[model samples]
Target chain A: MSEIHALSAGLALDASVIGGKAHGLVALMRLGLPVPPGFVIPTAACRVFLETGGLPGGELAGAVRELEAVTGRRFGDPARPLLVSVRSGAAVSMPGMMDTLLNVSSTGDLRAAVREVFASWTAPRAVTYRELHDIPHDQGTAVVVQAMVLGDRDDHSGSGVAFSRDPSTGERRPYGDVLFRSQGDAVVSGTVPTLPLDALATREPAVWVGLMDALDRVERHFRDVCHVEFTVESGRLWLLQVRPGGLSGRAAVRVAVDLVDEGLIDRATAVRRITPGHLRAAAVPRIRAAAPPLPSPDPASQDSATWDRAGSGSAMQAFPGSDPPSTGSSRPVTEVGSAASSGLEILARGRGAGPGVATGRVAVTADGAVRMAAAGPVILVRPHTSPLDLHGLAAAAGIVTTTGGLTSHAAVVARSMGKPAVVGATGLTVRTHDVVVNGRSIPDGAAADADADADADHMATDGHSTSEGTTGNDQTATDGRSTPEGTTGNNQTATDGRTTLGITATDTDQVVMDGWSIPEGTVITIDGTGGEIVLGVAETAAGDTGPHVDRLLRWAAEESVA
Target chain B: MTDLTVLHTLRCMGFTDLGRVASAAGLAPEEAESRLIDLAVEGLVTRVPGAFGGWGLTEAGKAEDARLAAEELDKAGARAAVTSAYTDFMVLNPELLDLSTAWHLRTVDGVAAVNDHTDAAYDARVLARFADLDRRVSPVCAALTAALPRFGSYRRRLSAALARGDLAETTESYHNVWFQLHEDLLVTLGIPR
Candidate 1:
């Protein structure tokens, strides 16, 4: 049997044979979308290569000849070279754990790239990801070789990933990041800041319109919210990939309901789509400010002392009673409203990997975290975590990494420990003794000793003895009873109460540097449910699913009655 | 050079107790303690006194360990071989971490809940995968041992952890041992963690 198959509308094969990516490309072709022309080397070919460690030499050369003819350019012909991207695509999506080589022009390099992509299926990270996700070990990945559509071809060129609806909030709007005059890899790496997807509308209007149309058509075709990776080569749009339905939790529910409202899917289908896991995740407590921003607290009256006292009082009142049993649907809005009134300014945002709320001081290193934990609760902030940081993870009240998604090691460990974690906060940078968030540098340890001492003096005048003014020393007093006034009485579980109070009491350092820098000892509350990192302590309210979930469930009930 | 076995072992294991440092170094606790005391007197290591405290390398100890590790690699003429083995080790590193994380957390009903180890079948599946990974990693360990004999201790400790079913959580678990081996590779290759 032939090991190669052209990725076209007429190609009919199971994902097991062609791999999910090839299958999706064929689907996009079938929908009349502008998918870059490509061909797939089936998984069986990879299996053979794995067994014999040799490519089907004649067949690969013949396939290249056919691709050259189709693209009207010769391979390795520098005058009009036909470069292709060689990518790994298993039946299952093992995102970011496999290899992909781009801009290969020579036949030898192309063959080598294809071999590498096939071999990446068993790459240790890929193997572990498969093992964790229950993907079969023996099902080797297929190789997809597509003619390159260079996003860096011109000023009008760009690459981006777009969701048909907002992946975070499930709003019916295109949401994604775009990098102009760069390849898709640059966009995915998060090394360079990207403009909003709307930037394409102004710069390359035709490509933007085409992308929107493609998104609409795919959503209709799949009957679900879709994510697409697209590239514009000199203003001509080419879709590199498309996948349906990876929206999770609240976003998933919102998309399902929105789809029903749009007549793309029925209510029964919407009900069937959301699982118990989605319901559970949707019910996790989120900071009230994560939704539409509450009116900013009046800056003129926002004195640190007054704000702390007011915030403390409101937090206690926010959770006056035991948490109401979660029903996976609506909750009383009054609780959320009361918590939202605290008016905490958000420092940064990222994907919520763990569920709950945690407030603590930031520690840039694991050892720093361990040292800081003795004085008060600490949040271990790192560029990324390794096994070496395990101890720091253990000692921290919560965790934050400037990079990595929910499936990253730091996120997994945070969830394992039941600690609130925010990951992929790309705007944050970790340094040796400090962290820079956005443009503000927040010093830690010895760098912040001067500020801590000054804050201690400020606290003394207020008659609060929470600050020891000796943050530089390892022998900072651990007296829990000296908790700062108006920082206690929150309904945090008894197990967390001591650390929570300790963190709040010790975070007496006033924000310096034009109220931009939040020093190491400064208090910050993180909402793992909503991915919000807020300055100061903010009360968490159980994620209010708004009306979409209630409406979807109501439809399900009606469908069952019928 | 003075024997840096216990010191190097402690350096890789991060902060840990004497028992674990001894076990990883393939020495008795008393022998490890003697070495540790000797090293501490030189201001290379320190014993932290607290609930979370243990014996850890001081800044000077870490620098000394790195210098010694590089010296050992060069003296043995195993830099190229060890570097190649380190490359192979990195491929298995992520899988080990994934397994460790899986042992600690499982997705039930789509939410990441703590594994709790109640579901025997789930635990068995994870353990089986660990064993499978261990089998695959044997060659990499073998390559490393051939390059440097001290690397053999990792192979022994990893198998022991698997045999004892201490996959994660414990200080002597397979995850911890694997983690130390990763650190050793970086230290030997002069690669930054």
Candidate 2:
């Protein structure tokens, strides 16, 4: 029971003993997909360690010997060292709440790492997470000590997150982020910018083919959509983690309907997959998305150096002459009426923490956001956030920050406060009232310069509110103030008479945060769910769900008999 | 020196009515008003006249509070201890927000629906966890109190909020008080928002 077991398809063990993560790995190996050879020190051992504060010792040595024999590597040898990552996983998933130590080689390192993982189940954060989620605190997590297969081993090596279907729209395509020449932690940390997942096809064809086959097998096995974390080492692909069917809302409907269409699952099962909650979430309004315009030839953008970096998809998309985004929620070859011909340009992309859209003038500093918000809707854009920025965040229509992940302070606060936010746009830089993204600066102030003074005066007098921000290009003086509502449209016209794209606010139920250098007074729309910040009211927001979503709705209606 | 009690109370509470400021400061309305008036006269405070009117710190007032708080921190020589306590509070910060969010929205079967608080057992569970969290938070509060006496008010306020049994739906609820305390620590330590 306390003895570590080798991870293989044949070794049947309860999740309580080996944990869900190791169980998933075993299933992947069973499906004839690649998983690294490793061993699991069981949850029973964790209970023992927690009680006595030490491992049984000899069992771990035996497990290491088995791993060494399987992988043909020496542990702690300077010439041909074998490394392991010690992680804590429970019967139920407790993602990222506990500690993990990677690249442990020495015996001391291994013991310390294992001890840390065992102890980490009771980490205050983990305890708090359990308290919120109603997971029992007493269940000690199983420790997974496995051989470290390097993701950053070579040019052909990288790590990625892949969904069997698009998570955003539930379309039948693999979608997620990929980081070349980086480890799994880099992708999780979100500190390193990641390329789109499709880059794998061109970079490593064999790995891509292997991944697709694995995705198909896993989906067929689970009879639903699945997501996996994978790493490739020197052209060899390996699956690290797998989970099935966490799709939600409209995406949930689309998946259920599509799976039925693909004959992977029956219609009754599709109906069962949806609950009343899915219907309600599907009803939430979204920002209509349009493909952002390629950046016009700016000298800095013309330089190949920026796009030369391996799979800089965002940067490549920024160039107007370059190819449209082939991956992500943005359509490559499949979707229709989603393309941008109206000259709307995307300045940056980040994690959408909040689920609605809003548009406003970009305010770089908290003081600026606080002051500027009085005049018009202001999107507070910062490098990162601190408690000092609360007043500014409170005042702003939406929030955008250059750094921090979905769980970062800015993201957490924004979601709790119910403001649409996009965080962790790595290349974003703010200067005064304008934001520069990927070396292509969106001079927000410059576009509004013609009327900056007047707008500032209007803001000071009228006090922009939610009601005032949503008035279309024509509505005026609703707040009983002389602030000109009709004048904002003037910023949309350039000297050449080609319409300069700017975000325009309209009365709608969706939440959008726009900081993409639209003219300060120009209204814009955003889809917080899709992490899309676009200029102008996206014409395609809610009125169009297409044939796929419509079929789901019809099927759901038939199923509920409600 | 400067009325640190009233100023710091307003600082933590955001824009609010005189009643909350007075109650939070452990003072009567009249006493709180007098202090606010004095602070207003010194250009450290201002009142907005509207349907949602309240007295709030002006730019000058916020600066003065920051300056006074920093000076007070140094004067008490409790910087290190207060910082240590702040670290502990930070570890509890996300959990605090999680509880608050759960109180507002229930994630059922992978969907987030507004929590009606109709389920007595669920509410009880949330409140019990809040109590557990409070027990863990007590030492952090005590450490802050050891460093700065002014921080003792937060301990009292938090305990009182818990006694009142507010999980959600109150501006001065336990969650809100804890939020303010979190903000106060950040502001007191001259940390960013």
Candidate 3:
């Protein structure tokens, strides 16, 4: 059998042979999506090269000749040279573990690039990744040699990765980041800030429409949420890669249920797709709108309003403005609370680096965090964290950074400590003794004094601010919320001045929004699951599966009974 | 000449105790304390009086350390070598961070959970990768050491951290030492953080 196979609809090879990337390209071609013409050197060829340290003599040359004939361009010709990108595609994804060479226009360079990619499979980092992920080492990666589509070809050109749905919220909206007049590498490098994918719609409407159509078709074919990497050359859209099913937790559950409603999948498939881990992740306490005094007559309209309110909290919120939920049949799985209804204002929003909800007083410095933690839970806020902040991070209940992304040092450490973290709050400013968020300069140390006063006052009134009382309240809240009679139990708990979970009357009384400065001991709630930072303790529904999860679980039970 | 070794070490390590400064600078705790006191008299460093506080550089100490680092580099005529090494270090830096993150969080059933270090095989796999990365970083370390002798301590400190299984979380962990080295490179090159 030939070692090289043309990437086409008719290519009949297992992913284990051609690698997942090439197989996806084959699927794209089969679906009639525009993909750059390419030939794949299967894993067999890579194995042979690894053993012999040389390419098979005439096979590569012959493939290149066929490619040249098809494209009407020569490999090394100066005018209109056939530039190509050589990429590594393993059966199991080992992201960022191998190398890719782009813009290769010469035979010699192509050969050398192929060799480097093959050798990279055995690179120490890649090997370690494989071992950690339990991917077999002996199965080599296929080399995908594709005709390069220049994203930098003109002012109308660009590259980006688009998700069929919002990966974070699992809202059925096309979402992603795009870089104009730059290659795909720049988008992934994150050195340059990217425009939201919707920008492509206004700038290159034709490409945008084509991309939207392609996304819809791929989602239908895969029967799940799909992500595509694409480049538009002078306004023509060409998909470079396609991947399905990377959504997790709440997003995954939402997508599964939505897919069932769309008739692309059945109830059984939807229930089967959601694992127990997804349920646990979905149950992680999220910042939701406090239950409305009266349920809205129309839940669907209320759902959209809730989405707008929740999205408005983030400066980088990338929802499709003015678009209703994609599926009318799908209900809101997680209802977010509005500021007016919840009686809590969002101070700032960021990327959720860790998962869970934490309520604490703000501590601007690491030292302050340690000192304040002796009295109450503290949230360590920083411009960016370093090794020096390790102790502060350890001591804090949660972490917030004014700068840095999800993978920053602060984020990594916070996750290690199992603390909820929010990073990349661009509107936040860290001063010497305080933090400024959304034009409000909050004093750090003054809150500590205020908390002491509140404690003294609380002792005089109810004696519930003590450590033992707080623990008892927490235990009652946890047990109450787990019972079928949770709503009544929670209402009763809230009626008592000091028995609400993570909140006390003294805490709420001090939550006054005075001219700019929120004292250091003023309570705030952060939802690391949704990246929402709310002033004062916001109500959290820890185990509420919501309407979507409830409907899916019901279907699962019915399917089992049948 | 004032021995700026202890001062620079403190600058790179951030606010740390005398014991950490001594261990990182390859000096005895008493010797490190003596130098810190001398620097404190000059208002280059200060000791915060609290449970969380320790010996740390003041603004003056930070400026002095930067100046001294620049002068040391020029005197050794090692700026070019150090810069080249820094370039190489940047390539490995992300990979190291990725490894550290992998050590802390592992995906189970597609949800990332804190690694409890219960899975012995998984821990062994991650540790083996750290060892592999350490091997690859040796050349970069050698190049930096050739440029400045103080950099030789990093090679020893990193290996010791790995040997002690202090991959992350701890003050003396491999990740912490690597972070200091990154800061040292930026300071030595007179680059902004």
Highest lDDT model number = 3
- Residue A545's lDDT within candidate 3 is 56
Error of 3 at A123 (Å): 1.4
- Model 1's A-chain: what TM-score? 0.72
For model 3, residues B84-169, the per-residue Cα lDDT tens digits are 99999987887788788778767667665557799998989888888988998999999999999999999999999999998876
Candidate 1 local lDDT, residue A25 = 92
Q: What does the lDDT read for residue B83 in candidate 2?
A: 93
Q: State TM-scores per candidate.
A: 0.77, 0.75, 0.77
DockQ of each: 0.27, 0.33, 0.21
Worst lDDT window (10 residues) for model 1 chain A?
A306-315
Better structure of 2 and 3 per TM-score:
3
State which candidate, 1 or 2, has the greater lDDT: 1
- What value of lDDT does candidate 1 attain over all alpha carbons? 0.67
Tens-digit lDDT string for candidate 2 (A1-562):
4778889999799888898888888889889999888888888888888888978598888888888888788787777788988877788787767887888886778888888998988776677667666788777888888889898998889887777876656667787667777788755644344566777888898899999999999999989888788889899998888877766666677778778867888777888887767666665555543443244332111111011000112221211111111113222212212333333444545555565668776565555566666677767776676544565677778887655544455665676677777765544443332343332222222222312222222212223343434434312233232223223422332111112223333342111122223223344444454455555445434433344445656766787785
Docking class of 1: acceptable
Model 2 misplaced regions, further than 4 Å: A51-54, A124-128, A131-139, A152-157, A190-193, A202-206, A234-236, A289-431, A435-520, A527-532, A539-562, B1-3, B6-23, B27-70, B168-171, B190-193
Q: Give the better candidate number (1 or 3) by DockQ.
A: 1
